[model samples]
Target chain A: MITKFRGLVVAGAVALALSQPVMAENVEVDPWEGFNRAMFNFNDGLDTYALKPVTKGYKAVMPDMAEEGVHNFFENLADIGTLINNLLQGKFENAGKDFARVSFNSTFGLAGFIDVASPMGIEKHEEDFGQTFGYWGASSGPYVVLPFFGPTTVRDGIGMYPDTLVDPVYHLDDTGARNALYLTRVIDTRAQLLASEKLISGDKYTFIRDAYLQKREFDIADGDVENYDESNF
Target chain B: MLNIIEGEMLMKKSLIALAVAGALTAPMVAQADATLYGSFRVALMSADDQDLDLRDESTRIGIKGDVDLGLEGTKGLFHWEGQLETTDSDAYDAGTGTFAARLAYLGATGDWGTALAGRQYHPHYLWVNIPTDIFNTATSDAGEWAQLGNNQHKRQDNTLAYLTPVMGGFQAALGLVIAGSGDDADDDVDGYNVAAKYSANGLYLAASYGDVDAIDRETWGVAATYDIDALKLVARYEEQENAGVEDEATEVGAIYNFGEGLSAKLRYSNLELNGNDGDQWAAEVEQKLGKGRVYVGYFDYDSDAEALAAKYVDRLAIGYRVDF
Candidate 1:
């Protein structure tokens, strides 16, 4: 009886050991090589119009603190963005936007009212698709400019489905309302990126596009930024 | 995992033996009696590739039960239960005697409801069950939704829990668990947590708050449940903070009972990290077969903010799991 019980226990243990399973998680996005810059411009224009007013209002309200806090939030959020970019491209690209995204989200998402990350006493972060892809072992295929969504890769495009699905705006049933909210979120996010506009002194669109691709590449190769071009754009 | 299971199994066997003995003597005795009981489970899984070297981690056995304190007029009470693991999985049974039993307590039922002491699961676990949209051998529920700090809010040690007697289709509970403060100069007794829950038929809801003394690690969560015919739906929200860092996670899930010992489920999880405000999301599914279950899972994280970033983890597998 003792031996039989031990055998039963051992059999159970081995069975449990064999049942654990592992699966792969990786996505690759092919670059969209042509057309659609107009679409990006339209989205950018809307973002600019919406954010400009909010930024001005913020400036007028608590100018000093907002400015400093916004700066800090952006800097903090950039860590992840930079990490992502570094994962995509050996050298971090779109450093400005990467920094801005974190700052913008922090102020609005947590502080409740875009205190620009100050009132919340929080910092901004930086994380990009490249780093995200690197972590999942996904490949950054060709770059593509999505119509209203802007720059993306095939893998990133597929990824956008879940991303949007989780966004509060998409969960809304009213199409008009959802669009409005999405536009607002976009504008709010972009507004924080305004500071980056001054950093790039070239054809802004091409600079962003190339930088985006470089960043994606870095992600595909896990931050090995040495293989790409840095001066063409 | 294995050690916890062995302990659980031992506890269960002892409890069951006690229960059977009591049951056999119930009619002949005029006096009240107490008893105990529990369960054990084990499974096996395999893959073709040698390089994969994948091992089943969810397989395990356990036991649980309670001793009855006989009394009259709904006064005397007794109860206890536990789920243990018997494998060296990353959780529960980490071999070498460490065990991760879900409930290890003795509680009593009477006019005051149920009062339990010892290691017990937080009420929030009820919510965690709702998000397992997909049932797979491996689950990240605890790490994704259970904790209040870097720590999870699920199975807690040294806890005191009180569950009010069911009244008007409603039942509730409050739990206080021990936590360690991060300060080196201080002992591990960080603070305590308070949690409450209510359940009415197939509908359930709960809320909890945790405070960790020296640090600003505090949390609040809410969960709700509703069943549609044979299908059960669940939703949950948890918000937490640690001084400068804030984290929030939400989940929606459903379990469909096909009747006759068969079921299917799916769950989704979204976690938002606030210091930088990044969020992560996951979805999974599972199916029940006689004495066994099969499952799959997928997860992703992303951030448009500098602080929050997104990544993905996908899994697909099949295995036969059983409990005895």
Candidate 2:
């Protein structure tokens, strides 16, 4: 019985691996976009309730230094992000875009580096390991809410490895500060997205749901209009 | 005879398992022929008070492959690697044996990026292993990675890693190393590391940070190399801190190719370990000969002079290395 069970386990793993190719080929719109929309709202809540006040408090303590550090940290972190995106896409030239993002965002975006996406004319692209897994044809397993990382799927959860591997902040040496900074980045990003609420009409859940799916579609295509297949997405 | 039959059965089962794993991973990187490859080295040396004789480098091999799953062109990846050392080798003697370095895992890729799970490299030492002799040295190897006190598993078990798609030469990766230790004290014992790198022509730059539990460690380095015909120049700097002690290390080197299976290189590296106020310098040169390479290296410690010298530690070594 034990031998049979062991054999079954191995067989199951192999079957699962083999089936992935087929599963990925049949693309379907994820209904869980609504669920993710809720996360967006929750993330917005944290930004409004927690991050904003904290930033204000920190600013009160040492406004200039804190603001400068925050600005530098974001630029450095964004550079890291841009570099990783370039490596994954095999576009060396586009990677240089981060420096442009950092320079203009710091100088013109007002110390807040506030949503420099529009003024600098750099389109915001959101991607995580899950999307990469999707590109690689990995089935988007069930959605999950990581304790701290927010909304994720099994495939994306796994993709996190190489994601952070290419993130500079991940390699920082200060534990407390690193955690605070990481949490802050997530919160700040969420806060920035809060403004998009103005763009959406109708149920909050539907608005975010449509937005996330549409945004994911754009990111996976690497912003290439030729790669865009709206019908399938 | 029954015992022999049982052993044979076990061997067959293991082989079958390995074959299945290979098939699953073959498709992921099948396009680039870009494989996942790394090596592990472990050794034991008995340094004499006068001669300072060291031990040979222990080594292991790894290979990885990626396959594009047809579903939306998502991909699957698998890697198998392990250390080959006395303790973990099949030829282990009767006394003591232990597991050292061995990593195996499977993962998938999609529009979001890539994800992986199982035993794998930690982001903490990613950049540290990129340059110089710091990682491969027989004296003070990069194995100090696990020594950092905190909640990080360094190279961990039951891990999940994610990588973002590269956009305009930029990308990011994040990992959550799960500590299976059920104890409450170890609950926060998870390890996380992230890194980002940019490469264009000869200029390559990267920075990374890794946190294992509460102890945060980082490596921020910049390296640039330029090749003009047969000659090339290389320079790099790395900074690291553990338990609040900081070490700043830098390396500069150059290599020249002399046609027909021949090349030469000379490089210097300095490490100031944790404000002990002591600094160490290592210089090395290598010449290619046929399928093998001959190398000469010198290591010197400027701080603990008499004590270090008495150990016959500061000296030069000439050796040969060949890769298969």
Candidate 3:
């Protein structure tokens, strides 16, 4: 099943990459200047040669409805983690909102293959352990680039350990099945960036670094930014 | 996507029927506003006796509504919740349905504070127990009994409570739980509970006192939590005198967030009841899933009782939880 799917994903990715215009936005921050720039080049090569193509093929092969469902499923799962952070930061009301979303989408939305809650006026929120630390007044420190994983930070890197302990994918004992699911999640996420990738302009590393820090701030603040411009996106 | 199209078609065909139903029900529905809320959970587990056990985790449904009293800065609030018995061994064996009460109360809040009177939870239960109540099925509700007994508030019938507005990161509550009101009963008010709490800078402290008139018992406890980095530490101590026997319990728990939706918990408690002593150790790992929250846990109980003393390793549980 996967072998045939791969062929289509490669074809789709090539087509999509060709269609996207090369635009770069001037980005300034590089905490570990040399290390970060080198890592950025490495990640870009991996994305260009491998990840991007696979995600493109994935999008091409799956029906819009199926694609929507896959996206919704991961998002619903993410909310469970968000709910925990909400409680940790003592945002009880927001936690309640996420509880409602998971309940509605998981049941009525068919295991979160559909987002039944959003139409009901409930906004979806996202959070990570890094943001949780940030909420508790811990600074992001300095931005860093991971080898296989893309953008991250010193604080976020430390935050990764706890999230790893609780990750459901790791709980799955079946290695083949677990690895496959992890790959799917990664591809789905990368596929999403395909569209937004066109929005980059100037130095790609600086653009992503600044965007990452700003986005982290916004998430920590629970989306309470004022006069937010596209740079934060 | 499909549901919307289907709903639109259905609405178009049922426009006339809806017009009639809406006209008849609109007034009654508009008169009162209430939100339907509940957390529905069910789990399949190995039963206490090592049998395959399928059980419900306090699965409940409730409704809460508010009324504007026209008085400035004052409003009336009421809420009621009931448990749904799912896969109850009794129900499965007997084929019957049971609806048990969880919480039902009427309260009003103003500048002064909030006053609630009804079948409510004693303040002691809320202030001291919530920290350890993390699991979907085998939380402190079922597991704490091995060590803490019934000292925490699950709820009480014929009770009243008052909560002070928070000031300077501090709040206080006082409540009473009635055993019964009858001609022969010596003390209709079976228990009185009081609690106070302060929260600041990721640090929280709470203390509660309970007087059980029916049993002539007095219980007092203090609980605290501090968060640093990705770890949170919790400690609790309670001393109670029951039937002229002094019993004390101390619990220490640590929760570490591995990251957003995943975390682990370790809780250890030692209790001395009368001349007998007991201890409980529990560890659990929880993760967020698309459908709900799933958890795996291990519990150990060591007590002076014959049954527990013979075999210390008690139970292992896995469960899922979600509420709407």
TM-score of chain A of each: 0.46, 0.55, 0.82
Output the chain A TM-score of model 2: 0.55
Best by lDDT: 3
Query: For all the predictions, what are the DockQ values?
Result: 0.01, 0.01, 0.03
B75 Cα displacement, candidate 3 (Å) = 0.8
* Prediction 3 global C-alpha lDDT: 0.75
Please identify which of the two predictions, 2 or 3, would achieve the higher lDDT against the true structure: 3
Q: Which candidate leads in TM-score? A: 3
> Taking the tens digit of each residue's C-alpha lDDT, what string does model 3 give over B252-320?
888776554656677887767667777777776666655467665667776453243443436766566
Q: How high is the CA lDDT of each candidate model? A: 0.52, 0.55, 0.75
Higher lDDT: candidate 1 or 3? 3
State the lDDT of candidate 1 residue by residue for A189-225, as single tens digits: 5556667767777766667776676666665554546
Candidate 2 on A1-233: residue-level lDDT in tens? 99999999999999999998755632344445556556767765875687767755655675565555565556556565665665566653344344334433443354434644334344334445556566666665655444446555567678787788867678889999889878777645544555565787887544554465456556666666565665866
Which window of 10 residues has the lowest lDDT sum in candidate 1 chain B?
B44-53
Lowest lDDT 10-mer window, candidate 3 chain A? Answer: A21-30
* Model 1 ranges off by over 4 Å: A1-233, B1-61, B73-102, B126-138, B141-150, B178-190, B257-264, B274-285, B298-312
Looking only at chain B, model 1 earns a TM-score of 0.66
* Regions more than 4 Å wrong, model 2: A1-233, B1-54, B67-70, B86-91, B94-100, B110-112, B132-154, B180-189, B215-233, B288-292, B305-312
